[model samples]
Every structure is written in structure tokens, then in C-alpha cells.
Target: MKNHYCVIMSGGIGSRFWPASRSSYPKQFLDFFGTGRSLIQQTFDRIKKIVPVENIFVVTNQRYNELTLEQLPELKPEQILLEPCRRNTAPCIAYAAHHIHAINPNASMVVAPSDHLILKEDEFLNSLSNGLDFVSKHDVLLTLGIKPNRPETGYGYIQASHQSLDGFTKVKAFTEKPNLELAKVFLESGDFYW
Candidate 1:
């Protein structure tokens, strides 16, 4: 797994979860489920199962540096790439990719949010390992998605073919937060994942 890397994106203001999550203390640092570990810690645990601890990097806002270190003491100080400012996901990812490339030129990375809660962690890890393997040998970008239980406006949706292709389906298009009407239609179609 030396060639594998994981990038955790934890810089979002988490405005959607406002009133509870503010700029100084975002949702990723909170333990909403009272699990002792914060959301980002949980994410790190999950990713570390597949990727080596040293190979995992966190790309968060510079402000969260102390909080991140306090929570995840297992990581080296260099593992955290604090952004001077929040420029959104694309730039955050690019920044992480650039830094990680300097360390491992032929690395394959799995980029994920720091607030996700997975119930079936073993299954999720298995799927992630498979995706990492698939991407390592092919010059392609593969997205791992969850089967949405609800039409959540907070996430992007992937539209795929109904026909399964070797346990995978072809992606038709990506839909931004669709209205309730479109979301219901997508649910009925049985091919949209968030």
C-alpha cells in the first residue's frame, strides 16, 4: 500500500449545519453521535484501514491545524496540509495532489470528506480497496458512491445505467442537487447514487 494515499478534505465551513457548526468549530470536529471520536477521526480510522498512516494526508483550512493535531495525534505534523484560505474542493485537492506527488510520484489517491459516517465499514473498505486497485492499473478516475437512502440536497448525484457491468455500471451524467421532483424521479429510476 506504499503507492496508495488518502486525502481527507475537512476545510468546509459546514454552513448547512449552522447554529451548531460555526467557522471556528466545524461539524467535522464535533462528535454528533457521542462516539468520543470526532467525525474526522472516524474518517481517519476508516481510511487508515486501507491506506498506511503515513500515506494519509489531511487538507484542511489553516485555522483547524491545532484542532486537527489535538484530535489525530497519530499523524505526523507533515501529514496535515493547512490551506491559507478556503478555495473550495478542487483547489484543495490539487494542493494535496501536488504535495503528495512530491513524496510519491506514482501514488494513487482516494479523496474523501471528513464527515462521512459509514455503518457497514467493512464492506465500504472492501469496495474502496477494489477501487484503489482498479485505478492503480488503469488511467481512469473511479468514483465510489453510496446508495442514497434519501434525496439529500447536500450531495451530488451520479446517474448510471440500469444494466450492471461486471458489478459496475456506466456513468451517464452527474446531477447537482436536483429538486424534490427530480430526486423522486431519480429514486424511481434506481440508478442514481450520492
Candidate 2:
């Protein structure tokens, strides 16, 4: 099997989080819940189970390089790709992809958000395994979307298709967070969760 690689997207400044999440110290580096381990530290521990320490890469802004290093001392310098400016996800993924692709032509990678909260560990792991398995043989972009639990205006919704591949559902369409009434209907339907 080809080595499964993961590129964690940890470059966001998280403006909504406000006072706690500053540009200098983003949420991923903060231990908001007093878990002793910061969010980024927790992420590394979780992903290491499936991907090797060497195969997992972290891409962040040049400014946060030292902070990331301070937190994740196990990582070598090459494993962290530091960007000079905030070019957004596309450029960051592109740069990392090109480098990884050059090193391993048959590489299959998963790009994930660093600050997501998943309640069900088993379900999340199953979905992750399914995604990694599917991507190994398929040349397609894959992202795992959570169901909208409430009609909150904060997040987007994924409309899943009936089709299932290795227990993974395909996203038929996406719905923006609706108003109170619409969100109520979604909750009543029990089809989505946030």
C-alpha cells in the first residue's frame, strides 16, 4: 500500500474567536479547554495513529513557525512548510502537494482542518479510514463534512447522497445555515447536526 500522507491546514487566524485567538497565538496553539495539550498538539497525536510521523506535514505561516516548532518539537524542519504570506488554502495545499508528489509519485494525501470537534471517536475514525481507503485508489478530492445539528448561522451544511462507498456517503449538495424556522425544521428532521 502507498503511504498515506496528511497535510494539516493550521494557518487560519480565527478572527471570530477574538481576544483568545490572536494572530500571534492562534486557537490551534492555545489549550482552551485546559487539556494540557494544545489543539495542534492534540491533532498530531490523533493523526499519528494512521499516518507516520514523517508522512504528516504541517503548513503554517512564516510568523507562526517558531510557535509550531516550540509545541511540536518532534517534527523536523522539512516537515513544516512555512509560507511567507497568507495565500489561503489553495496555495498552501498546492505547494505541499507538489513537494509531496515529487517525493512520492503515488502519494495519497488528506487535508484536514486542525480545530474541528468530533464527539463520536469511533464514527470519526471509520469515516477517516473510509476516506483514506477511497483516496488510495481514486484520483479525487475528499473532505469530511459534519451534519448540521442546529440552524445556526455559523456553519454550512452538507446534503448527503444515498450512495455509499465503503460506508462513506457522497455529498450531493451543500446548504447554507438557515434562519431560526428553517433550522428548526432541520432539527425536527434529525438529518443534520453541527
Candidate 3:
């Protein structure tokens, strides 16, 4: 997996989960589940199984640089991509992508949020492996979508076509946070995943 890389986006202020998660210390730096590991730390551990620890980059705000370093001390200065300002995920990803491409032009990256909780780690790893394999041979942007078990308006949804090739489906469109009624339709149609 020499060409594989992981980018963990950890710059959000996480205002929704306030009090427990504040601007001084976002949710990504906290061990909210009593797991002994912060959300970013857990994400690093999980992704390292597929990509080398050295190849994993954490993109966070300049304000949280110390927090990230404190949580994951093993990270080198270069591995921590400090954002001068919060421009959201796209720019954060572009920064990392440019850096990674400069280092390894053949790099295939898996960009993930730092504050996600994965209960089925083995399955998640398997899916990641499959995604990596798929991208290695194709020039396409791939994203892992979870079949919504509930009408979770908190997350975005991907509408995929019925076509499935090598366990990967063709993404038709992306819809962000549909209302409860539309969410139910998406769930009932079995065509959407968040």
C-alpha cells in the first residue's frame, strides 16, 4: 500500500455538540465515548491499518495545532497540515491533496472526518480496502456511503444508481440534509445512503 494515503479532516468547531464540545476544544479532540482515545486518535488508529502511519495527514485549524499534537504526539510536523482559516472540507482536502501529490504523484487517498464513530471496524476496513483497490485502477472519485438505518438529517445523503461494478455503485447525486418527510422517502426507496 505504498501509494495509499489517508487525510483526516479535523477543523470543524462542532457547534451542534456544544458545552461538551467548544471552540477551544472541538469534539474531534475529546473522548466522548469513554474509549480512552480521542475521535481523531481513533480515526488515525483505524486508518493506519490500511495506510502507513507516516502517510496519514491530519488537517486541522492553526488554533488546534497544540491539541492535535498533544493527542497524537507521534505525528510529525509535516503530517499535521495547519489551516490558517476554516474554509471547510473542500479546501482542506485540496491542501492535503496538493501536498501528497507533490510527495507521491501516484498517491491514492482516503479522506475521512476525524469525529466519526465506527462500530464495525472490520467491515469498515474491508470497505476501505475495496475502495483503495478500485481507485488504484480507475480515475474516479469514490466515497463510502452507509445505508441509512434511520432518517438521520444530521448527515448528507448520496443517491446511487442501480448499476454496481466491482462492489462500487455509480453515484447519481448528492443531497444534503433532507427534511424528515424526504428522508423517509429516501429510506423507503432504498436508493439513498448517508
**For each candidate, what TM-score against the reference?**
0.91, 0.84, 0.96
Error of 1 at 82 (Å): 1.7
lDDT of 3 by residue, 11-36 (tens): 99979899999999889998999989
Tens-place lDDT per residue, model 2, 1-194, is: 34788888789897879899998898988887888988888888787777788898889988888888899888888888887688887899998899889889888887867776556767876777778889887777677876555567666666667886766666676667777787777667756645
Better of 1 and 2 by TM-score: 1
Query: Considering summed lDDT, which 10 consecutive residues are worst modelled in model 3?
Result: 146-155
Residue pairs that clash (backbone atoms under 3 angstroms), model 3:
none
User: What range of 10 consecutive residues in model 2 has the weakest lDDT sum?
Assistant: 147-156
Q: Model 2 RMSD to the real structure?
A: 2.6
List candidate 1 stretches off by more than 4 Å: 162-166
lDDT of each: 0.89, 0.79, 0.92
lDDT of 1 by residue, 1-194 (tens): 89999999999877888988888899999988998988999999999999999999999977899899999999988999999788988899999999999998889999989998899999999999998887788776788877788767767899987665447666889998888878888877888898
Query: How far off is residue 81 in model 2, in Å?
Result: 1.2
- CA RMSD (A), model 3: 1.2
Residue 141 shift from truth in candidate 3, angstroms: 0.8
Model 3, stretches more than 4 Å misplaced? none
